[model samples]
Target: MDARVIILLLFSGVCLTSAGLDKYSFINERKTWFDAQEYCRSRNGDLASARNKEDIILMTDITGWTESWIGLNDLNRETMDLYPNSWRWSTETKSRSGYMNFAPGEPNYANKEEECVDIWTEGTWSDGECSSLLNFVCFSGPSTDKTYHHINLNETWASAKNYCRTYYTDLAMIENEEENQQASSNVTDPAWIGLSRRAWTYSEATNQSFRRWWSYEPDNRSGKQFCASVYKNGFSDMGCTSKLPFLCSDGIARKQSRIKIMIQSNLYLTNQHNKDNMLQQLSASLTRAGQTDFNLSWSTLPQKLDPASLNDDHQ
Candidate 1:
């Protein structure tokens, strides 16, 4: 083969390799401990099975210390595993990997019940109860809500419901096709809603009150359910795990009014301050000009000098 052709082929091969590596990448989101593992498994990967302190730190920085659920769990204590020691991450069906970056004296298996895993700071791992509420991390993919807000930060389903109640109304009860599209467009994370079969019957009588799922029917046989949340493009059954994101809405009119008031207040304050500063400067100039003589008794100036007229030109 010609030398030029050989060089061109080598360059093309390098570009293909780089693109393939990039294709294997994934983004992360908050999820329940169990769900996070399941998510990793479903994707043919596990919650970043890091193997060193550097890897842990890298993940923490990327996830903003937001506390995401990893693949580690001790649900099967039948294997003679302790809390932290028994902690092993499920790679789903991926290859087994190890990342031992633990805190000082960590993986001590403090409590038998503490089987779930989480990353604290850097590569450090800690054992937490699977049921205990904590932020979770899930690999990124299409989600329910399309937009997100800061007010939706770190809240459980129950807590989110209450928050919406005390501040505004109930958890966002998505209704109609328009609302569904709006909800999907505004989700940065999965959010809890008010559509659960645990609290009420999903029969024909109450069908009007609940949001419909886009796909699979949730196993709502048990009545322990009391909340609902948006996932993918439809709603889903979820426990009140502190691992999901939430949604809050401000009616467009109310939000616009508030914004207008804020703008008006800011303008008023700025103008008032400017007026005061101008007055002070004028007063100083008058004093320096030896115009104190003009500060006569009120009787001297029968017609009060209009303060507004006292400009630089008048001075």
Candidate 2:
């Protein structure tokens, strides 16, 4: 027997299936930071956001040993040409602008490398190199809820930011005095905060604020480092023009189905030539009927079928 598309209207219900949700995708294509972000936004969700250890691990598994672009970037001076040393938070902050608690003579840009800030034990802010291996904080949830956690792992400011975002929030933004106090309250030593100098934003918005680093990263050591890349060694600054394989994530995964066409023809249907001819006829008929978005093929099973039984009304 042969299968064919019948010219009849039918409706059927199988099972409920979701189309999409929050998830990650790994793209093996190599692109610059900006190009990768564009690719992810158009195709998947966004550039991989490994804000915590789990996120990092998941994306790392997708990346293997290759360096890949992530969402975190300090592009203020690159795109806007703003003051190189101006302070900005890691993106996705809950705090309003113009509020600061800098320690006296703090952020002196000492030795010309102190570009990131830290919340000292006294809860006051000080600027240091982005490479400093210090503990960091991650703020999860919304500003109203304001959940914070202190990470004990020593990492540089950039890595700390990535850590918080991958796992929790963006790096603790310290939305207000009370939230700030709450963030530092549980710390036994100085740690990194979400606050840093630059208009850094992830590929997409998220509530996790975590960072990890090696000894010193994102030092702008050559005065050209702007984009961020993940390495087993930790995060480091690279030029946005650098080409590297990047990570991507999807919203979620869902079920997709195809139409099942069953035939009742008594020709030489088992022959490959006959099957191909039937499929071609079905394709032409569908096109003529303005049903251009269908796929026709030979059935993979035995031939006891009914058009009425396929209809939901019959069921």
Candidate 3:
């Protein structure tokens, strides 16, 4: 009589492809934002993230300067914190915050839609809708006399920012009490200032601050313009259901691979149940080791060991 032996085959490791910056493609077909997202994902991509002015330029050039959907959106903002992380100054040089002068019970974030700030009272701030038309203040040079200029123009926050940038340096960046007082001077009503924030972010959640907004864009006039779309001038918030062509971005390159490992085991390797248990154990070990991207599986059949070899091994 001769004894038989089985050698188990295990597939281990995963395929990885490191990616640089995202590469975008213009899909001329019109689809709603959700449909477009699904289509791009089917093609191993997502809606585009125009990370900077240069990227926006490239995207516009590719789309022939047409209105198209991008991945930036604020759909999930209702559940996000309306605190320090979300608020930002329109001016790039302005610090996040140093001096604080908020009207009592200010920034109540009213209905989670008031992402923009305004001078609710003299030298005090309150959150307001970005779409509200109000007088605004502009700033230039430094926090000196006559640096902050009050403009009696009834415009939205985005429009005010653009108006200030076109004429003065930018919207008023009230860093301290003096600047805040200057920004609020002679203002008897709530006015738009440089301080405002939008909850929009890219699908991939990249931490890039680059944005190229069209004048008065992202006004959130309908309060439902949670999705971002690119136009000839720049980007604007749009309703997600609006049908439009979109840009799909290949986030990172990836590939599939397989590696083999031989396991000499005396256990019943032919049992499908045993193989499944082994795979689960291996997967758990890999996950614990911080290698989550890989998958594990066993080959369909085991290699038969030579009779002589099995006898020698049993000796």
Candidate 4:
């Protein structure tokens, strides 16, 4: 293919197949899961689908603590069977160390509204409502010194986060057993920590069996927690109406297009040199057009093919 046009001049027909490159984009606007789906569709895409670990990492790295929505959900919870399959961190910028210390039988999604988490004495964690007024702990500088400050003033989870950010670093981030113990050492009562759940699917409504759930999540305690949200580590169930940022995937990446042209030259159709030159020129043109990830392939026409049978119409 030339810069302005592609020309084929040979005895037989030549076919070129171009494969698209996949991409995942994080949309910062907050919207309900269904609304997000509509927005993505309007833009010729859909809610992002993490088909594998790489997809998950790519999408997660786009934003921090935004708790972006994914395509997985249990909208048919009443008819279709489901299970706990997700979790997240309160901070988006920091990496999750995969350390968890939930109390046994805890995180039961008490009252079916407990999405925020708190730590009690003995370093055990529990899920509770974000609006619950509780004293929270904040860490100054880094966790290296185990430097944590317990604010006795009662505040909601959101308020506590602001308070901590204004004074100390942020809400205490407990990365491991020792950090969890240190954060809880001075806690005489359950207080807010830097951990929470936002918490599903591809946007195409294709049921995917692959799941990345927290140790204990998707409890579906409310039975109405049918939607799924994503964070750093895993996914978690949330109410469908909850508005949040989301990830959208351009579906064009998975599609491959094929174009066939008739050759008019007397040279043999199997000429490797001609094929190589055509491919190099075509690849260069595509690269100049800012398309680098596409693939190209060739197919030969049948022996009995007639040049007059080829049409200019491209599929």
Candidate 5:
């Protein structure tokens, strides 16, 4: 091949390689045990089913949380059934024959009626109630640079729009299926987004239009659902008066850092209210420097270093 042609082929190979690597990145988020499974399925993957101690620890660190869901379920409450044998993997590949590496009396099936599987800190499987709400883990296509912002309180559709505009660039908008799935992970409460039915017609919308559907389904049944968010993967016709969390985007770094400092200072003051006046003054000064929005009262400070020593000092 000519030198130029060879160089072109090498460049193309590098680009393709980068794209392929990008497709395998792991996403981290919290979801209902079932939603986690569905999220993985939607992305052509499954809930992270850890098969060994190392894998479990890695997952624990990835989530930075103690407990999360795995893809194990006891569809049949058979006590004699050994897990990894009785339980089928969510991905549905053939299960590798394995031993029930329980820690002492584990898989206790505690009630002999437990039907779900969860990983304990000991790196072993235990039976849990399937219906009980627990945080779960889901694996999917590679992660992206998508950022999320949570709205503080409920607001009218117009007010929500204005808030996002004034603070961030626009109300949170999902660009693709990956972003949509990722957004669902952060939401603990219902939130508002850029999508609306009354503010704009769905037909005139572009692919990037402010309007969005939670899951791929649009809410055409009710006259509400004029707002959107990352909490649920679908839209609901909810009244605007009903307060729910909302989403924002494009946050400034300095503002976030300042907010975090203020919160920390407030927490410190709350815990150190009985300290010396100098310390109390110092806390107040720090709070002010942080530009905290809340008031920190110091009028209740005790006059004596130790109230019990009041009589002793007088003596």
Candidate 6:
């Protein structure tokens, strides 16, 4: 008796094609928190974004790989020297609820010129250079249409903002995902999303809204441990300089993979049976990891293995 299996991983449809969706991987390189962020973006995506339990399992699955730097952090430390003050919002036009939607590894002040935001059509957000041009969304006060208005025009963040104030109200202020949805309802493409770090807007920023903190976590020890990391069980706070291996995710493009395996039935029926079971498990794992669209098939080798070749010194 003999058995064989083939497995394939593929990306199909709009959800998987999204430019800013997260696909996670474990990195074995060690670097400080900020350094890890740079490394991840330079190579993969940003530090791993665990949007929920499923993502958390994907990032922290391999046990003993603790202290891996993630994307969340207290962003004020970098500018303590230039500003000499605590964090503050970019503008006073915030809603009473004070909702925010920053993308992972964002508002890092990575680019000195990044003091505004651009929300993509897919819903994820990122900081934008203040002078960059894009269409914008706006909302008015009680006097006018208070929902949202997508202005299709090219203008810098400052100009777009001013236009809103002059005509309707301040640029659209999104206090939560609900408002994010409401603002996006008017725009079918990317646009300025009224978010920035003018005066150190918020202390923390990341696309993920979920957290899994370790015991007594986020201690902010020594007044410098601002970045976040994950351990075997949960998360902990660390300084920007603490070097450690990290995790990352991919969003720029879709991924595809092919795997082929052969069964040596001549050895033993038990062995062949075990190999068949292993492939079944592998198929399950690929699906569990959010890989839904794929193509798979199996084919016998054109020829059986030559027994003599198994030896190192074959005649």
Among the numbered candidates, top lDDT falls to 3
Query: Which lDDT tens digits does candidate 3 get at residues 126-244?
Result: 87999989999887653333377889889999899889878876777777777777778778888888777657767644434567888898788767787899988499989899999
- TM-score of each prediction: 0.21, 0.39, 0.41, 0.43, 0.20, 0.39
Candidate 1 lDDT by residue in tens digits, 1-315:
111100000001111111122121234555654565456556554443222344344444444544343322223232332322233222111112222434565434346444444444232345544444433222111122212122435554445544644543334333244433443343444333332212222211111122444366444425232234433333455443547433211111111010001111222322434334333333334444532212111011223444334222110
Number of clashing pairs, model 6? 4
User: lDDT of each structure?
Assistant: 0.33, 0.65, 0.69, 0.67, 0.34, 0.59
Q: How many collisions per candidate?
A: 19, 36, 0, 14, 9, 4
lDDT value, residue 15 of candidate 1: 12
Model 5 poorest 10 in a row by lDDT: 4-13
Q: Residue-wise lDDT of candidate 6 within 138-188, one digit each (tens)?
A: 765431124678999989988987887677655676767777887887676
**Model 2 bad stretches (over 4 Å):** 1-22, 81-199, 252-315
Model 2 TM-score on a 0 to 1 scale: 0.39
User: Candidate 6: which stretches are off by over 4 Å?
Assistant: 1-21, 77-206, 251-315
lDDT of 2 by residue, 193-309 (tens): 977764454556443345655568767767788878887636778899899988776653332344544556766656666555445445434544544223344445333545565
lDDT of 4 by residue, 53-82 (tens): 666666677766568888887553332212
Candidate 1 lDDT (Cα, 0 to 1): 0.33
Candidate 4 C-alpha error for residue 233, in Å: 29
Q: Considering TM-score, which of the candidate structures 3 and 4 is the better prediction for this target?
A: 4
lDDT of 1 at 129: 43
Q: Write candidate 5's Cα lDDT for 134-179 as tens digits.
A: 3332222211233545555545444554565455434444435444
- For model 1, what is the error of residue 102's alpha carbon versus the real structure, in angstroms, after optimal superposition? 31
Looking at model 3, residue 161 earns an lDDT score of 86
- Global local distance difference test of model 3: 0.69
